[model samples]
Structure formats: C-alpha cells, structure tokens
Target: MPSSHTSSTSRAPWRRHPRATVLGTLAAVVSALALVLALPGATSAAPSSPQAPQPNPPQPVKPGEAWMGAGVQMHEGDSTDGSVPDEGRRNLVASVHGVDVSSHQGNVSWSTLWNSGVRFAYVKATEATSYKNPYFTQQYNGSYNVGMIRGAYHFAVPSSSSGAAQARYFANNGGGWSKDGKTLPGVLDIEYNPYGSTCYGKSNSAMVSWVRDFVNTYKSLTGRDTVIYTTTNWWKQCTGNSGAFGSSNPLWIARYASSVGELPAGWGFHTFWQYTSSGPTVGDHNLFNGSMDRLKVLANGG
Candidate 1:
C-alpha cells in the first residue's frame, strides 16, 4: 500500500545500467546541442566582418589661406602692408620653418635671424641654480627689436629647492622673464644630461615635481602659465603620468630630427617645435630654442 515502484538501488536492470544509460543520453543531448550551435544564429541577416577604414580625401585651402604641411595651416588676415619687414610680411609660402636659440651658442646677430626667414624664437633665460646666462642681455632685447616674436626658458631645479625660492631666483635674477605679471611666460627645461649632474636627480618623477613647482610658482608671480620643455624621453618619464598641467602651457618640444613627424605620440598639443640646431647661430655659439610662424597664436593667446 505504501508504493508500487521500488528505488533504483533495488531494481537490478535500472540500477546496474543507469550510469551507462544516463551517460548515453547526455552524449546524445550534447551532440544535438553541438549540431544546433554549428548552424547560423537566429539573426543570420547580420553583415560580415567590418570593412576597412576609408582613406580621407585631400582638400585645397581657401584663398589667402596656406597649408604649412604636417597638418599646420594659417590664414593671414587682411591688413595693411606694415613695418613687420618685407620678408616676415611675405606669404607663408612654405612650411613653418623654425630654429631654437640659446645665448650659450647662438652667434648670429638678431638681424641675421630676421633675414633668414625664421619666424618665432625661444631664448633660454636661466639654468640650474648658480648657473645663469651672461649673453641673454643682448639676445633678449635683440629679438624684441628685430620684430621676431620671442619667449624665455629656464633651466628648472628640483622641487626640493623650495618652489617659491626657485621661481623667485630666476624671476628676480635678470632671467629676462616678465616680472610685472606680464610678457611671455617662462619654460622649464627638463632632460637628461649625459655628463652633468643636477639637484633634480636623474629620476623622471623628481623632474615632474620640479616642473610643477617651478611652473606653479612662476604663475603665482607672473599671473601667467609657464611652459615645460623636453622630449619624448622626459614626457614618457614624467609628464605622461602626472597629468597635472594642461597641454595649452606652450610645450617647447626638443625634437631635432628630419621632421616634426618624428616626435612621439600621446601628447595632446604642442605649441613649439625645436626643429633644427644648424640654423643661424646667435653669436658663434650653440643656443637652445626654436621658431614657428604659428607661434603668433600662442603670443596672441589663441
């Protein structure tokens, strides 16, 4: 009266062969599932794999606009034929040709730089503590009078120098950067010295902190952003990680190669490109900066 069916353990045929039968059933189900999966999906209308990206078509520049190649172009607005020199005033018939200069090695007179068809100039103003330029006096004022747009650079010290003190030393010590909260901002030069030593040490982290300290302090004093100059090495080692400063801080990248295309990627914006070391020297010496026609945009706060 309790139950008619017995447990599989009590049934000889079912219990002894249960394992094999269950295994066979599972195999059949798996094979059926495999066959179903092998067929196309229910939504078989989907297209095939992605098509290759289409190449961008070339386009011509509008009248009065010029292509400087390497993705730089410019438009010289309508203006009177002024006293900006016949050469500087000429149309941008070529790419943005430029060269960096330092008071240390540039030997050409300002007029020579102006006549050489160069555009903008960045002059190194200061070096690490206790090392300052002796020739910047003439170079700074020369670039101004020659109508060549100019900027200043500083040899940055480690943040361990006390941020405000480091900035003050360069700002007050005839570094030629603007002191009255106006004029072009400063540049913090951060790179490895093959045979030299620095308070910032050889670590890229130290260099990043030093750059931030120097730039912040300079801005505190001058009410303007300071530029940071370096190359692919320093960027990878330092700025790429910190992510504090904006790309708009007028980056002066030192890439002395065949072209600006050789510069590394991931840097969002580059304001200045130090393209050559063999251009007109300031005074028979190797200077340390560059020139760019589009630098006028930086000057005009573009």
Candidate 2:
C-alpha cells in the first residue's frame, strides 16, 4: 500500500501553494459584493425629512344637509319658500353673474368658468372651528388667479364652537379680506343647521347675539364687514327676522326664486342674491346687484 502511487492528497494544488486558498476565498466574496451593488433595489441617496401634517377636513354634509341653494333645495321640500328660481329668471346682462362652490365640487375648471361669464366666486373656507375645506387652496386661489373677484365663506356650526372662536379660525385659515381690487370681503354663511334643529336650538335673541359676535370678531380681524348668507324663511323662524345686522354686515340672501323676495328684517335691500343652485353651468349661480364698476368698488372696500 505504501508504494501504490503518488498520494492524491499530497498532489493537491492548494497544498502546494497555501496562499491560493485565501486569495480564492477573497475573490468569491468580492464577486458577491459586486452583484449586490448591481441590484435594482440599491440606492445611495440621503434620507428625507418628515412632511408637515395637514388640517382635517369636515364631515360630508349629510342627506338633509347642504350648502348654498343645495341646502335650500332640501329645505324647500318641507319648508315654504314658494317657487324656486330657474335659468329662465336669470337676466345676465343687468347683473354680475357669480357662483359659490364647496368641497362637494373638487378641482373646478376656473378657465372654463371664466369663459362662461362668471365674474365672481365665493369658496367655502371653513366649517366652525373644527374643519377647513380640503380644497381651499385650489378653489380659492384658482378663482382669483383666473381674474374672478373671489372671496372665502365660513359655514356656521353654532353649537360646536362659539362665534368668536369660529370667526378667528375662519380668518386664520382662509376667510380673510384685502382691499385688493380682486378680493371680495369675506362671507359669514349663517344658515340652517344641517346637523340638528333648524335654529341650532337657540332662542331668537341668542341666535342674533351669535351672529353679532361672529361678524364683530370677523371685522376685528379682517377690517371689513362680512356678507351674511342665509334664507329669508330661516331668518324669520329662527331670529324672528331680527334687523340687527342690516346696517353693518351686507346681506347675501339665498332666494332661489324669480325675485330676491322679502329680506330678513332691517336690510332695506339685499346686496348679493344667490338665484339658483343647479344652474346651466358648473356652480351655483348668483347676481351681484350692481354694475362692474360697483363690484370693483366693493372689492376695493368702498
């Protein structure tokens, strides 16, 4: 057995050169490293910073709830506001045609609206102190950028927060006014409470006081009186048709009818009239009861 042949273990190449085993191992390791670096999932970029949190959006208006004439449309079925206005009543030449939009409509076409003869717009900015329209920047800035006299409005939720608190929230968020010729004064949309009882369970005096507090606070912050948007019938039933706000705040009467109809209490005439919700165009239609020069004057804080 000792003389059989050259032993196979003694004839091994690595055994003859011990460094070749270590070099071969290192070469295999380097090949694997190159493969990992070549993979599609690999990256050499730096880490990113965290993004800021966005404000929460409000709950969707419920089945019986709405904004502008849409609210009135629902209210008219059970309530009395005889004869809703249609496109037949719209005399566009005599009055400024405008529209009001909320989150229900997302990412509107401002250019198309401009070409359609819409000269002004009111965008829903906030709902009480708890919510802001998620589409505010797009709706608010989009309208203004397109050469429309644009303003922001706050939906009243009297029960959830005080008037002062809500007003502050509105101003800090989007309901602000400037003397710029294109920006209309901010609006206070005090209308029927979609969440509960029509009057928000407030007595006539209490509701009136709430409205007063809101407009006062809003004025203190924005240096301009707010336009009050509401229905005549709701005002009659809830505030007992109080004429307290007539002298200061402009009335934005929501009457979906042939005429602007009887105003609330003290106001001798309505300033802005929302004539129709479902219109021939994209948004709710309105009439600014003045000429273009007068509308510009109002925007300039005349």
Identify the candidate with maximal TM-score.
2
Worst 10 residues of 2 by lDDT: 1-10
Provide the clash count, candidate 1.
20
Clashes of each: 20, 3
* Residue range 1-302, candidate 1, lDDT tens digits: 01111111221232334555544443343333223212222212322331111122123322111111111111111122111222221212222333334432323255544554444455556555554554455556666777766666665545336555667777765543443222355666655332224223535556566666777778777666666665664466544445556443555555444333433343454555543232122111111222232344345433
| Models, CA RMSD each | 30.7, 30.2
List ranges where model 1 is wrong by over 4 Å: 1-96, 159-163, 174-183, 194-204, 238-240, 261-266, 278-294, 300-302
Q: What is the lDDT of candidate 2?
A: 0.67
| Alpha-carbon shift of residue 244 in model 1 (angstroms) | 2.2
Q: Candidate 2: which stretches are off by over 4 Å?
A: 1-66, 77-91, 279-282
Q: Compute each candidate's TM-score over C-alphas.
A: 0.55, 0.74
Which lDDT tens digits does candidate 2 get at residues 1-302?
A: 11111112322233334455534433342333223212211222212321111122133345312455544655653232222243212333235667787655555666656765667889888887777776678778988989999999888888777899989999999998887899988888887776667788899999988988999999899888888899899999889999888777788888766777788888876678876554212346577766666678778887
TM-score of decoy 2:
0.74
